[model samples]
Target: MRVVRPVLGAPSWVSLIAGDLDVAQRFYGELLGWDFEHGPERLGPYVSVLADGVPVAGISGVAISAGTGVGWTPFFGVKDAHEAARRGVDRGGTIGVGPVSIDAGRIVIARDPDGASFGLWQGRAAGVGDPPRQTGVPDWIELRTADAFKAALFYGEVLDWDAAERCEVFYEHERVVLRVDGRSVAALRGLDRPASEDAPVETPRWQISFAAPDVDRAAARAVELGGRVVRRPMDTPYGRTTELADVEGGLFSLITPKARPSATAGE
Candidate 1:
């Protein structure tokens, strides 16, 4: 029998720090059908969220003194956590946590030059588990930053990710593109100054995007399911998108492609 190596180089893993783990678990569980698995070691009061028997995300207990706000921390796959941390620090980033072992992986938390925090995971068991495929679970990660070009260069140099193509949408002021070896792994969006100033700077904190087959239906269902619709569904050249906040107040988005207008039917 051949041992199956875990899937690698996909960007879909993220973490959330919750004031109450039970409440956070309940919200995501009801919303995404995630199963909470508490490790016996109990790495500093955090539990892991698993999907399809694989760890996909985590919920950590919040620290009042640490002044860490509750939000999602996206993790990128890396060959070596220590080396990544060194490069991040050299480029004006700061390490918030260790190249330390937690569960089946070694991860280091670091902030970008602009003070957005993200994680670098060196997998010992499997690489950030498997990609999500169902509704409610995260399917895509988007980084809305001040400088999309700088972010692209920073991540490309650090993680070896390549930009597949670049395009601009009417809704966005700057260019947006999908980055991956070939498949659509993630997106980079340029940020406006006012938005960036009001956003959290310590961590690469941003709204998570959930894959929805139908954008309008998902937005409607989110409201009916106790989530609040922060932004109405709108069509963009890239895709249709809507924003919602979970019952626990965690914000996320749902995206789908726009349909062809009747004016373009003949074309």
Candidate 2:
């Protein structure tokens, strides 16, 4: 487990909001080499995913009363969840859920002005390390929205993210990388219509991507484990990627990153 200094405005933790705790735990445990540590369910049906005896990520159940969608949620670190929620309100963000106290810390679920949902985690939980970036752990996140510039501006005001002006134009969409503390942590992608083609409009969404050394192998493994392969591994400018969905319809991706440039000249 790696220890990381608190980086405000960067993703400190990522959690899946699942419908069934058992199924979610089982699906991820097998795929990500994680084990579950259940939390007090009275507050929320929360569980921490541990890998090699280190807490890596979390899964929580949305109150049936509220009726929220189930998927992965990224939480940014804050000193005080309540105060952060207030600041978000002052900055035009909406607090969708509580600054409720749990055994470990206080948390608030919020939506940025662009209507992208995220979380604010204010206190440190015991024994939780920085989530791993190695193969099999969740390593990256991207927000697919209608307007990348407005989305960046809205979140920049609330979280102080240094969102880049330049967007990498792809065939179907445009992507802008977001940096915090001088490091790229997340991305904002404009979900535009496919080039010169008509397609159904898609709502904005945040997608979670896990890392793999061999994305093709990972995609095959996912199919063997009762998951659906939405897209086969394909080479892109950035990496090799395969889109997949769990048995219960939770969408995620596997990526083999592109090699970084060497500082030394080519041999």
Candidate 3:
């Protein structure tokens, strides 16, 4: 439940690919007080989501289509994407996109056995890693799946990460904490199906959490900026947080960390 910094297995980078670039810029800019700066010219409208002039995540402009999945994707830093995809395939996950080249790094869009999507990145540019979540930065990456242990084992063998610890509050549901080199990197938790819920339910997916300075204030700002607040701000032992969907329907959360009570400050 306590997070100090980012380790190798945790989310090193995160990004959102949506239909509208302008909407992404305004919504995230106001919500996180982010400064969206253009990336390389070839990327075309792709921008770095920065806080205090530090790159935290990315916002890419992708053509809108019925099949497009608009959501924040977590990318884990790896030594090599090609090798990671090879090991991922051996562990039962499928490669959805590439071990393809990009301006900053090589990337592989991968899915776990239970259908949760994640990314693997081997960055070539500097400032790609080091430093963890701070204000206006990505705070956490979590997997929500029905088979918590199954997903844990998949990541363990595929990524050499140990999803080993059970969280304090969600112990009944099995919250597996991912650790890399003795440091907690990310976490996975089992999703509950209400008894009255229908079959053919929505599959589990990885979610992105952004560090916020003020929970209620951010939640309100999101609504004013045409975003939908799925869950209003609520206090927790960790911090105050709320779920929100961007104008493009990409889901993410804004959380105020307990470590810094006033305004925001990251890895």
Candidate 4:
């Protein structure tokens, strides 16, 4: 599969770290119609996920033994790993891993002040790139946290997003949208309060979404593969979307794009 490089300060890649690498691979491959390739030796027991002959994501067993939670973590592109990590630390984010060398690049995993986990990569990435919309690839990312503006400020400084020449950050509705080259790649939104007394508190984290052809059918197949539905499919302005957890409890969402109405017959 061919690889594409993401623009600096944009989302570069995403990874699922699990102790049960085989099961994780099996679950996602079946759920998302993905293929796998042996990943870089430096990543240790890793597999690169391919969608329609293009590398889109990865799975690794490197940090599971260290008690890292099993979840889909997003990595943002950076010009300098060390500088990004330093800025993140200065802005109240905590680094969990290193600016260590990995095959073609350097990476550092860290959590924002709100405890939302993310990564920084300063090299060629074989995942999300400019105009990131693609089949079976992670298509959208959202940060659910207590404060949207604060989260925006932290990421903006750490990722050097202050320059309008590269990207633009703006508020829309109740969320902050991060746009690169005219495309909105991610959004930071405040966590909604539980609607009733018995609802569970939403956790602060980056959520990944994949485009699926059939929302209901795909969700059903996920269940047959041992995954659980966190939220039943529901209609939204974007599309029909559902939240789900892999067998190992990694969270992600599936969204079927809202169909554009066909041009009026013989208009």
Best by lDDT: 4
Candidate 1 global CA lDDT score: 0.61
Off by over 4 Å in 2: 1-6, 62-66, 90-92, 124-133, 162-174, 180-182, 192-200, 259-267
10-63 per-residue lDDT for model 3 (tens digits): 467787887888888988887788897888742345888778777777877874
RMSD for all candidates, in order, please.
7.6, 5.9, 5.5, 5.1
Tens digits of lDDT, candidate 1, 29-68: 7656679888644235678777666566777767433567
Error of 3 at 122 (Å): 1.6
Model 2: residue 126 alpha-carbon error in angstroms: 12
User: How are the candidates ranked when ordered by lDDT, highest leading?
Assistant: 4, 3, 2, 1
Candidate 1 lDDT trough over 10 residues, lowest sum: 258-267
Better of 2 and 3 by lDDT: 3
lDDT per residue as tens, model 2, 153-254 = 666655554431211122222467654323344678877465455756656767777777888987887888888897789986557888888867777887
Estimate, for each residue in 42-115, the C-alpha lDDT of model 4 and write its tens digit: 55688888898777888887656667778889888888999999999999999998999888688899999989
Candidate 2 lowest-lDDT run of ten: 164-173
Query: Clash number for model 4?
Result: 0
TM-score of each: 0.73, 0.78, 0.80, 0.89
Best prediction by TM-score: 4
- The order by descending TM-score is 4, 3, 2, 1
